[model samples]
Target: MFGLTFEKLLLIGVIAAFLIGPDKLPHYAQQLGKLVRNMRDYANGAKDRVRDEMGPEFDDVDWQKLDPRQYDPRRIIRDALTDEPEAAPAAPSPNPNSAYLQHRAKQQALATGELPPFDNEAT
Candidate 1:
């Protein structure tokens, strides 16, 4: 396959047959076939083992999402630079009279670079 056509393959085969000699060509071909078969079997066995370990959820996995070919470094960097930061989650409702609410409000103001209001009598 490797961009090689039938004629190219035939040429390679002729050269190989000549180099390897006709008597040994069949033996080498048989070895190559066995190697290919073994590789395929190994790959299939690995898949089967993974399926057994992960159960049905293995089949539900998004294979294309996991493919490395889809990853583009430039696109990823562009998105990182261009995308806005996610909005913060809503704060929990606090008791109106709780000291925790007062402290939280002060923290929020400080985080925003503003000075918290100081009540002389409350302090």
Candidate 2:
């Protein structure tokens, strides 16, 4: 399960048989089987206990969304960076000397080849 393919397992088994010899092989193999069974039982029991405690909410959970393997830092960052900001409110400005009006006037003057207004007191 931990990246050990059939050939690798076979090689490992052959090496174990040679090192342990035929005399005590059966005893060791039986012990190994018991250990594997115990580990499996422990995992199953833990899962069952959690399910029992969680009740119906366990089934309702979106397991895939919670999975860490599905997360990509680069994709998350890219999406965040590319997302557009919400448009500002369309309410009319009450102030006559607003920066938006000043900017618009400057843009209009520039388009008509006229000098833009300069306020020395602005700085």
Candidate 3:
């Protein structure tokens, strides 16, 4: 805590206001406000940079693990695709009858020119 007392701070403020007048005091205060905001922004950017470079390990790795700032999107994608064993999808080429059965019902209707059932209110 810099050991800065309230009395000392008040005295400094009083002196600054007296020396710099009322009109210029407002302008000086505005500039000081801008400097404080810029410092805060720089600090946040630096923190993010350090987090990304350190990876998932580090003491401040709370958010980094739950929702990481992606350094490499391709790496994440690659891991997601290959990490888990996938259920082999039933392919159509090897079993020819399955494919035929899928289309047979549709083919029969088309040949008869039956146009399927219609709904009056649909239009």
Top lDDT hit: 2
**Residue 27 lDDT (model 2):** 100
Model 1: per-residue Cα lDDT at residue 123: 46
lDDT of 2 by residue, 1-123 (tens): 899999999999999999999999999999999999999999999999999999989899998899999875544543454444333337744773454354455453365676778999998
Q: In candidate 1, where is summed lDDT lowest over 10 consecutive residues?
A: 80-89
The local distance difference test score of each candidate is 0.74, 0.76, 0.69
> After superposing candidate 1, which stretches have Cα over 4 Å from the reference?
78-123
lDDT of 2: 0.76
| Model 3 regions more than 4 Å off | 60-123
RMSD of each: 14.7, 14.3, 17.1
| Residue pairs in clash, model 2 | none
Model 2, C-alpha of 62: deviation from truth (Å): 1.5
Candidate 3, poorest ten consecutive residues by summed lDDT:
83-92
lDDT of 1 by residue, 14-108 (tens): 99999999899999999999999999999999999999999999989999999989886544543454444333225633543443344346553
User: What's the residue-level lDDT of 99 in candidate 2?
Assistant: 42
List, residue by residue over 2-103, the lDDT tens digit for candidate 3: 887999889999999999999899999999999999999999989888878887665655666576565545444434555453444445346535433544
* TM-scores of all candidate predictions against the true structure: 0.59, 0.59, 0.45
